[model samples]
Target: MEQKQFFTEKPRILIVDDELGPRESLRMILKPYYEVYTAKDGISALEAIKKNPIDLVTLDLRMPGMPGEEVLKHIKNFDPTIEVIIITGYGTLQSAVEAIKYKVFDYILKPFNVSDILSVVKKCIGRRYVSGEIKNVLEKTKRDTKSHSEIYEQITHFLNQLNESCYYFFRRENYLEFVRVLATTLESKDPYTVGHSERVCHYSSLIAEGLGLSPDEKEKLQISAYLHDIGKIGISDIYISKDGPLDENEWAIVREHPIKGIKIISPLGLSSEVIEGIKYHHERFDGKGYPEGLSGKNIPLFARIIAIADAYDALTIGRPYKSPLSKNEALLEIKKCAGSQFDEELVEVFIEEIKKNDREINQMH
Candidate 1:
């Protein structure tokens, strides 16, 4: 999709600056013609982009962390078409020239008039809006001229392309934001779950490597590990945050999260392998899990791999209800449950890898 495709409503621009004064002033001026949001720094700018939609970015050249050039590269990597305007100081002609080479839309000097910025934004909006409208018209024409059945097929193709573009365009931020929300929400209810997802992803990928799984299988396992508990998002805080053991009824609700998460992302057209991993990560090797009671080998390989990582992280991480087990203790606990709760061989391999890279692993997490 073109840069213009992102601007459908009012032009959305994210102004990033460390100085509160300039950031707010830019917002005040751009608010009239476009929807404007301000970021105190690049980190916040990236965070905001993940949570919201942005068409154009007006970026300050200097910031404590993540200077303008770096931010521009990130925005481009996230979505190549995202238009960015660099904010340069009057004497920073060299930086302005460098930004131009980096595909910045334009550079605006500091102490500039609001009307000057306004005019530049107005031109950007017109370019984006008109181009998007033209693309829409062309697609409509294609649909009208095609046979009815073909037209429907074409529509599906276009929609899928659009979804994929949007998916990648926002995937980096949205995915991270989703994790943050899940982690924070879980943390609010129970502090022990803090950083649970990230830890699981790291361990699961390592285990996948230890098992020498195929590249595709490793990636699937990694994604499933990261999102395994996404369904937990829908579970009520009353059930999730409880310091005491869940009652039978609460346990039943907790068991349904795999299916819930599967349902949530199914429409995204992810690989069936990834879906299966998410759905069965909680199932046991001995057929004693919730949602499904699939036995050893019947449980998907990716799911079995994740079970080890997920359980290990849970045991190692401090939870509201229980104290964190030491690494040795956690390993012993995992070994005890190997036949029933985890794939025994995978667990062994995971432990071996951990022992071999113990120091490196500590540094990583």
Candidate 2:
């Protein structure tokens, strides 16, 4: 008795070809150790992929409407993990070279035997799975490295801004430069929030320093503050800066910014403390906020501090649909909302801090 050879488990192979003969023939040869899926052309192959998971693809080089090369490009574009083995009845060196560039697992000529086909299929699938993992790791590493580079850019920008004479004009000029870059990139989606971030930074820094935060703490607070509204870029501008109050549908988009900002900044490997400051700045001392609403001391200390600062800046700054409040008026509004909307302790600190700088308040143009 002969022993039967099999794969570790049945691998799914999608056979894409115009003709039925090759598809069925290939299925018959590999069906013992593989679950076969057949697609008549590129469209069908794509549809099958969305409907079911396909591990490997045996693609014919020529087909009606969409050719193998075009199909291969789409497959790689959609999901590069799936290995594609290009098969051509009319094989040539040019075809092989083209296939190589497309990163096809293997290329086989016509009149191939069952053993020959299986040998290539096994090799292709093995290479595909391993290479897929390697590709994924490389991509993730690239992203991490890219994010580190961004942080490096942000830090460099900060250092340069700190040294610049203009930096003395505002604490967040450098940080706002970075945030503004993100804003411009996402301007098509949300211009209002870009300005909103700038406002938050301007206000948060004044409040942070007013509360006598250490220079280091002030820097972190300002960065977090400027970026607090950074998450709004993920939301559509139409929904974010709506001329009228946002409807429930648009409001959902407004609420997703914190999570989105976290995801955006997570790759930078920033300290969790800074992330939390941005995450919970919207919470109220009286327990009414979106995303997460923790009142009183339950919220992080820096977050509570920012809530007052953020609101102060927001009220003082003019919006697309509203007029800016006067400095003293804004102060009174802050005082009005102190115990309810903001942390009372931080509010008193902020008020005292700003009151001393009457000249600065008058010049906050």
Candidate 3:
């Protein structure tokens, strides 16, 4: 099988404008970072796109012939993945509205600031790179029955390339959005697990609040919770949505998810704490978990907290293989496993928070 190359070269960019000054300015600004191309007219721009692999385009709306709107439509029809940002000197509400209809990445007024242009371009390219990689990985997994090791290798390579190319330009908000997108994609694989990550995040946040964690620590924990199950994306949908108990071999494959999850996000420049939380969430308090078997406080605090949240949701939410337990039943199960599968102190904190939430819900009702 041919392995997909992940942004090993500078992304190709096309600048379209009739005015030489604005077109050349854009070319100069982006030339240092990208494989820049330029066109003086819409006809030339269309030809350039057809001939080259253009990742993005900056087009002036007020061009002489072949108006920018017509060019935008052609670009989208040819390759919807190619991001286009509209640059217009004669900005108008109708034109802006029309740009939105065509799904332009951004609309910038002419005489744009140098920093603003660079920032917008970086953000657009960063999004394109990440989204493209994710699509590639997903398509590969769906088409091939590759082994878990092969899948891991593919993900690792893709992430390394993505980090090298785009991490420097990705903003924190963009990273968070990507995490949410990944989490949602993972959940979509199994109908029974819809909203699983968000619920885990909510539960983990409650635990964090009960323990009086600092703001930064809480935020890290939330990101960890959202991404904790990301590795499951590599797992076969047959196993994920299996209606019967997994045999030993199947169980072993399923257990590799945490490590897979780690490999998926480790290169995205998240904090070590967040990565560790995802890696160790399955670890047992008595040192008997798969992957790594650190016992008691040996597990990171975020991991322990997430483990509790994860297990709670699993117990309360019905799955194909087992019926979900009631709230009290799930609480009892958690209490029973405190010393062996969870942290004792954190368990207490989580239970109190659950009861507090119940009280609030009842009061409102």
Clashing pairs in 1: none
**Residue 256 lDDT in model 2?**
80
Which structure is stronger by lDDT: 2 or 3? 3
lDDT of each: 0.72, 0.68, 0.84
Give the alpha carbon lDDT tens digit for every residue of 188-227 in model 2: 2344444565566666776777767798787777667666
Q: Write the per-residue lDDT of candidate 3 for residues 1-365, one digit (tens) a residue.
A: 01114457888999998988998988898888788999999999999999999999998887788988899999999999899998876546459557976768887777878888987887787667666766778569657956755665676677677665454545564565456555765475478888999899999999999999998888889999999988887787678779999999999989998998987787777899999999999999999986888888989999999999999999999789889999999999999999989999999999999999999999977
Better of 1 and 3 by lDDT: 3
Runs in model 2 deviating more than 4 A are 1-195, 360-365
Error of 2 at 338 (Å): 1.1
Q: Whose lDDT is greatest here?
A: 3
Off by over 4 Å in 1: 7-165, 168-190, 361-365
- How far in Å is the alpha carbon of 80 misplaced in model 1? 23
Predict model 1's lDDT versus the native. 0.72
